[model samples]
Target: MSRELDLKSEKSIEDLKKLSKEELIIKILELEKLRINKNELVNEGKKIKRVFDFTKCQKRHVAFKLLYLGWDYQGFAKQDDTEKTIEHELFHALTKCCLIESRQTSNYHRCGRTDKGVSSFSQVISLTVRSNGNNSKELNYCKMLNRLLPKDIRVIAWSPVIDNFSARFDCTSRTYKYWFPRGNLDIDIMNNAVQHVVGTHDFRNLCKMDVANGVTNFTRRIISANVKLCSNNDQFSKSRGYDMCELTIVGQAFLWHQIRCIVAVLVLIGQHKENECVITNLLNIDNCPRKPQYSLASDLPLNLFYCQFENVNWIIDNESVTEVISTLQHNWASHMIKTTMLGEMLKNIEDLVPDSINKQSDCLLQGVKSKIYQPLMKRPASESLENRIKHYTKKGRLKIENNEKN
Candidate 1:
């Protein structure tokens, strides 16, 4: 078809002067219609994909954030390249189980992009599926997807969000926490420094700017943030145990790597290694965007603590979802027992301590001497880097400082 168009286009402009602009537009529209119909004809599927005659219109759809453990799989969102992501897994489940096809036609929009080895507890997405989905259908969709889904990912709960309930824009806030080991950390000083992150400020210095999509905005509101020596998930551990410490931050959305950048600063301040004004220095009104000097915290330890949706009742559920939860409890008990057995049986397995874990090394004395202090223990993660020059350059422009450089 393109070859035919090339032949037609080869005619001299003077020779083709007979055709008017309106005639050219009509020809183009006609060609576009032909191409669309041809493509549709070629892609016509055999099952529920062709259930609706798209010529008429589309059915109602619903969207939700699909949380997944990206450690073993791919990223959070789906892509054309076909690495297994939460979106891809859900896509397969939708087609094979829920009988929905075509994310492009379905009008799906994910909230954010998370990298490999990252995980989210509250990742949000907008999608339109058959919205008349009743509990029976919903349960069926959940169960069927869970059956095929890898153990790491699960659709814990879903609510019927309003048409105006945008996962990104309408969000009230977003919170993230970076878990760090309790070893030699000055929790009091870190907690005091967290107070500075509460107010609205220039966060360019505290974030590794992501210029990939031309994003240079660095101002974000940090409504509340704090640091604490988190003990454990169980109440008994929280009450009597002195294990598992972490730094938690909650805010109304965040810039790329902002939490981790802030985490590094807090860590420094907590140790009295950096002055308190470091937070205030970055927040200077005259200061512009700048690249983050701190490296990003590990991915696995960071979790998407929660996503705030205004007035969207996220807890709507009945007996079916309850049953699913109960089933999950059962599965977890079984899996835990199996994992315990495996740990004991596979004694040869090398345990590489994560960044936030416990350590017996002389990190305290060494840390005071070395600017780069890495304790010899692994820790957990919460919601979770980059170039030095390019990062600061963009931020400088946003700050309207040193326009002569650019």
Candidate 2:
């Protein structure tokens, strides 16, 4: 009887071994489905409802310093068409961290409304937010928001300010920096040209006239404007196209596309396409009457470098500072590697080609380059600011005050 049982078992094992591969795969898939369903049930049970009562929390008015790489963002301001803005991401992070109930009720104000693709190292925003009931033992706003914010955007620090303080209205000055390569650009001439933009002037001819939005005054004071080599070592080489430089402009305020327009004219001067006196002529609205039709400089290299304020003490956390440094270093390393690779490729190509073939300036300017260069002052002009105001007024988009024309 034992021998007969053994023989039957062996026959069953043989039959199991003869099962089709497809049948085994189907059995495994069925087992995996059961496991997945069991996991889903456990996960569903683990879900918790998040409920925070904002009415019970203490609130404080504060200013936050933000740093962002704006190459991927539409702009710093929010818009109805897209949420791909720095402010949109910021508000999202604030809400996620329960810092504020909503932007509408937050009493929010920004130092500068930076345009599309413009980065900022010192963009500031003042707002009322949920506080921990003690000024000295306040919550870690930077860490909390940084956790929820995108990697490209970071909260550097925050400061408690008076309830009446406003970021936009109270800003003493703003500093903007535009980075560019020194590819065949006459840095000395560019530096000399920028000096003419300093001091108070009606810069209507140097910026887009925003009459529809009720911005009638274009008179702004530029404290200083200059171009300089970005690195000490790079200063030794003027002929090298890869060396970088920057244009730093300090101003009390700026109009739409003002810095970019100024940069476009400076670039033309640097390229020997326009005279340095072009800036002086543009500043004199009587001489220009209307802005000459010209493309603005590329917005990618522009950054809001600083915003000066009075009587504000920024509180920096050691731990958060270390983390920010680490993040910046990683970003720098990644970008540097790509830059070095491109530099090597460029060097290799230059070796194979004539030097005269690459003499053109590489600074990016918006719009197509005309084969036959037209001087900035000689280009076709846009409609005058007065005309723009009148057109908008006729369309019911703007209402000019009695003294606005002056």
Candidate 3:
């Protein structure tokens, strides 16, 4: 009987080999189903799935240093309406890997909340997560998380910290860089204008007032602000609208849309549409009680460059660092190829155009460019801060007390 069964199986294999690809696939699927049913009968009962026991694992509070290309993401913070966000991906990877039970139980805090299309090289987040025995024996966080996270978002490094440390409150400073092409822009005047922004001032007129969110305070300390050429090998004569420059602003904290708003005004100054003192003039709320209506700079070129922290020692995994470098190099090469191709096409087209034609200004600013430019002071303004406060208060978003908003 055993010899006859072996012969029959051999004959079946030979028959399958002669079948077409589709017929073979159908036969394979039928075999798989038969194997599954046979296993179920062999077990005599359904197998119970095991749950991960959090009680048996040790936990540690740590901060993760992250980098992301945010062009495709909604934003850094998660939203109730959409899951296409960095924070959403982070928590998804965490829970999927069983690193933490949930975001609420993880004691999570982000260092900075970047807007949509804004990339970051040094975004940080503090959270409590499952751990191994000790520092030397800890699980490979970068490797584990990177395996599950999308290619654009990466966990570069992590560090253990004190129990009371918060990524948001403990951060000493943040540096933002806005990149733009130097298209007939007066870099000297733009640099001079940015100097006026490098001190403490009431910036309510330069930012969008979020009265409904209870963010009435607009005073923020700027450590530094300037515009400089991003490349060292560039000459003014050879620029031809391809030379890139950056507006760098370092501050302790920033209000919503603050950096973008500042960049828009500085671009106006660079283009000779506004004087350098427009920065200082906007800072004085007594003179300009309402913010002038203006479009913000595009979010694509903005980057969170650095986040300053004190007294925390970051642990760099050599293997993980190597892997991250490799991944970044691959991404850089791909982008560089595309950029070079576009540059070649642009150069070819420029030869056909007349030199007398004026070079176009920055296209990264949001909204349509008007044929007739209006000065910043002459533009229509938003409602006054006091009026916005009153409106939100009437809507029950804020409470007033003793003639002051509480």
Give the runs in model 2 whose Cα sits over 4 Å from its true position.
Answer: 1-50, 232-238, 356-360, 400-406
- How do the residues 1-406 of candidate 1 rate in per-residue lDDT, one tens digit apiece? 9988877777655554778999878877999999999888777643324355444433443445445657765666677786587777777776665445576666665555566666787777656555444544554445555677666666655556655555666667776766655545577877887788788876766765554444545667788877777754242221222235676777777776676567666656766667666787666636423442344555556667677776665533455356556666876799779856754543333234333332311232211344465331112221111354366556663332211100
List the global CA lDDT of all models: 0.59, 0.87, 0.86
| Candidate 3 TM-score, true structure as reference | 0.85
Determine the C-alpha RMSD for candidate 2 after optimal superposition of all C-alphas: 9.7
Cα RMSDs, all models:
13.4, 9.7, 9.3
Model 3: runs farther than 4 Å from truth?
Answer: 1-48, 232-238, 356-361, 399-406
TM-score of 2: 0.85
Off by over 4 Å in 1: 1-58, 79-82, 131-140, 232-242, 285-289, 315-406
